[model samples]
Target: MSSTALIFHIQRFSIHDGPGIRTTVFFKGCSLSCFWCHNPEGRHAYSEIQFVASNCIGCGECVYVCEHHAHQLKDGERFYSRALCVNCGKCAQNCFSGTLELIGKRMTVKQVMDEILRDSAFYESSNGGITLSGGEPCLKSVFIRTLLEQCKQQNIHTALETCGNYKWDKLNSLLPFTDLVMMDIKLMNPDKHKQVTGDSNKRIITNARQLVLTDKPIIFRTPIVPTVNDTIEEFSEIVDFIEELIELRLKRGKASTNDANIQLELLPFHQLASDKYKHLGQDYKAAQLIPPASEKMHELAEIAKKHAIDVKVR
Candidate 1:
């Protein structure tokens, strides 16, 4: 019997995920349908096909390989008949320029840990560790917990970047082995959260509160999207929520009265996902949504500073 994990990517030498040089494992599947998702292809739990027309030399190799006649050129435009395609991957196999590609891979836990431990020297030197990110890591709690446990066995520091949408018990079970927990608070208002993410924020908010009560090192990340959650009122609500959590910890004797440190990071929006969406054969609806200007990002950093939360715009 072998333990396997369905992972989309294994990014090495990642400095932004946590402290030092770390390896980030991007798991597939997510519960929320955020409009601004960078890895839209990773949102699905299975492998997906991606086509890049520019890379095609019009060799018609894919047309010959696809048994279902899914590949066709009409009016000199390459069109994919997704309905008829069986995802046999024969077309991608026949592509020379890699105009067509597949996005997900299945690996056993031992295979993943082997790759992660290769950087053990780097982790020891920089205080870096393994960061499991996702579509929503909590959704794959069993795999995540097993992976984290293995990291612990190897004396590797472990971190999780989550959306905080899982049940409290499920999340709490992994905390003992996890060194740091990074979570996002997308929207405080329920209706606005639903309108933007197509899901309610109640579960996410509740899980965040429960996680913070454990008094573990937690970093709250908020994506600064324009005309959505980049308002002063939303920032204020976030601050208030943190303040409430601090109060709860005090009442429970979990924190000292003077220790008010809360790590928070504000991530500005970017158009990096547009090309990726195109590669995945998905529509890039938010391609025009530009990132905030440097000056505006600085202003928001100042606003977050006023709340006494250490804020970094990455």
Candidate 2:
């Protein structure tokens, strides 16, 4: 296993990520540049600095610690010079108030596994395990494969929450060890997908279709973004595509890839990521967007259910 990979966050006892109380390891870096990215800090492959204005105490500790003079305090207000900062995390280290933060770090596979293993008791009791999530966990194929293999050795359930925007081989390589795959289908229209995410949906769609052919339980999710894919027609198109994949798999006589193992999930859009974008010095493109109402989400779920697919709004 590779000794180190860039990691942005590790959320423990996370129920929304997967079944029961799973620990989610967020791998740093993403192939797509979605305009409404929640984890802007994780979008970058390398380490970056984040500033929290509210946490600043107006102390000059960071200014004293940063050799690059990246931290500047004038008239009690703090200003950061991003150009001069090396992202060495010195300011973050000195900021005891949790104002300055270093977003990503390099950690070995063993290091990650050890942290996941800490919650083994909870996993065994709650039928929970480890979930590999990220800016896009599929991007770190080999590392995730190794980590999942280790989890399987310990009889831990493994789930992958991915964007499904990688090569087929990378997704294929990890299928054997993955028990559940939570894939995000942002938009159906290729042109609209590229326009919003800065990447074509061809690879993502292909990966999803291929994943349906495997035995692992698959949950297809779509974040209900207003003006992007909130309309019934957009979600209806996605359901049609999934139904086709299921039909093809059945025709192939792939017993494991039955429709029963496939599920549809609808995630409502939220402004939670807006704060992260502010910390990263980037504007939140979807700041004005509001989360879909429960009725709207239910309507979308009903459409998916009409196709005989299990649907949930989470």
lDDT per residue as tens, model 1, 1-314: 67566688999999999889999999888888788887787788877778777888887889888889999976788878777877667888889897888777788888899999989999999999999998887787877888899999999999999888768888988997899989998778999988888788999889877876786788888888887777778867876776676676667765563464457788888887888887776767677787878877778778767766667888
Report model 1's TM-score to 2 decimal places.
0.93
Per-residue CA lDDT of model 2 for 48-137, tens digit only, reads: 999888988888999899899888898877889888988899789888898998989899889999999999999999999999988888
Off by over 4 Å in 2: 254-259
Per-model lDDT: 0.82, 0.87
Worst 10 residues of 2 by lDDT: 251-260
Which candidate has the top score in TM-score?
Answer: 2
Distance from true position, residue 65, model 2, in Å?
2.0
Report the lDDT of model 1 for residue 60. 89
Whole-model alpha-carbon lDDT for candidate 1: 0.82
RMSD for all candidates, in order, please: 2.0, 1.7
Per-candidate TM-scores read 0.93, 0.95
Best by the lDDT measure: 2
